[model samples]
Target: MSKISKLFKGSSSSSSSSSRSKHRSRGGPTPQEAIHRLRETEEMLTKKQDYLEKKIEQEIMVAKKHGTKNKRAALQALKRKKRLEAQLTQIDGTLSTIEFQREALENSHTNTEVLNNLSFATKAMKKVHENMDLDKIDDMMQDITEQQDVAQEISEAISRPFGETFDEDELLAELAELEQEDLEESMKSMGGLPSVPSSKLPSAWHGHRTTTKKRVEEEDDMHMLASWAT
Candidate 1:
């Protein structure tokens, strides 16, 4: 190539190399992404391995079929079988590596998720407690208790009878005084009874009998009233 052409080619190659390097240096795939890719690779490798196994079997059968009848043919078939087996073994190793990598990535993903959840919970708890303290909580509880006590007192007051209060002993004493006054008024209203005459006259006798009957009736009335009062 000419010098200019060579220089242009070098520049292109350098540019391509730098781009590849940058791609390689970019942030790695997430665990989920890497595991997905590993699983896909494992599946592809498994299919290849299966194909190789079938090929190996076919080669073995070919070798057997040519066994003594054609030594050269049998040798070629055997050689092909050996190559197929080697490829299969390599594929198996690759599968094992892929499986291990996938498992490691899964474990790492689970651990990361758990850590994130724990961090979230911690932040939530901190936010909830930001404006609170033990002293404030205690004060709130005390206030609640005081309010409850006040409510209880109000309830008790509401439940009581709505009426004027009176002393039982004082009421009894007043009633006794009223009964005494009634008895004295009854005795005074009767006034002095007519004096009994020593000498008997028909008129005097009639008057004495009438007075006695009236006094008896008054006594019976007083007894009945006293009984009613009691």
Candidate 2:
């Protein structure tokens, strides 16, 4: 019993000493130190908050100035930007997946591996056709130029015959002479009208016959008178 009491007394003393030591080690800070630490923390937090606020204000001002023309447009642009950012993230993920696939393929040693690949042959053909079309356009332009030159030459040739004036009187005289010649040729081909001739012979023949008959009758009367006188 006495040993147990001694042990309890020792434990109590040690605990009391440890408590007093802990109490003595704890000291009060100066007002200035406390205030300075608080002030420093506050200032740092304030500066951080201020910088964030300024950045937000600047972003707002920039958005107001040039982000969009109107509130609705600005909202739409923000939404669209968010959608684009999401699409970009998705594209990045897809590109990362493609890179990983490519790395895996490169690491593999199989010669008969199948892969999805894009062929640029069509695009190259399209470019070639575009260049060809451009060349054709140039050729068409040259052809047009040549045609214009030919047209100009033809125009010059046509204009070379007549200097500035035309002879109106000479043309009119030539037309009149042609018309007169045509008229004279037509009249000569159509001949003139014919005429008849006259004759006189029947009346004289009948009168001579009557005279002979009368002479014959007178001769007969003279013969009868000579016979009576004889």
- List RMSD in Å for every model shown: 13.5, 37.6
TM-scores of the candidates in the order shown = 0.57, 0.20
Q: Per-residue lDDT for 82-169 in model 1, tens only?
A: 8888878888888888888889889989999999999999999999999899998999999999999999999999999988999999
Give the Cα-based TM-score of candidate 1 against the true structure.
Answer: 0.57
Angstrom error of the Cα, residue 105, model 2: value is: 0.4
lDDT of 2 by residue, 1-230 (tens): 65435654765686567556655786643334334433443444344444445545554565566654676766655565555456545545655555555455444523323221123566677788875677789899999999999999999998886557769999899988876665555445545222222554377765775586678556644554454346
Global Cα lDDT for candidate 2: 0.56
Number of clashing pairs, model 2? Answer: 0
Cα lDDT computed for each candidate against the true fold = 0.80, 0.56
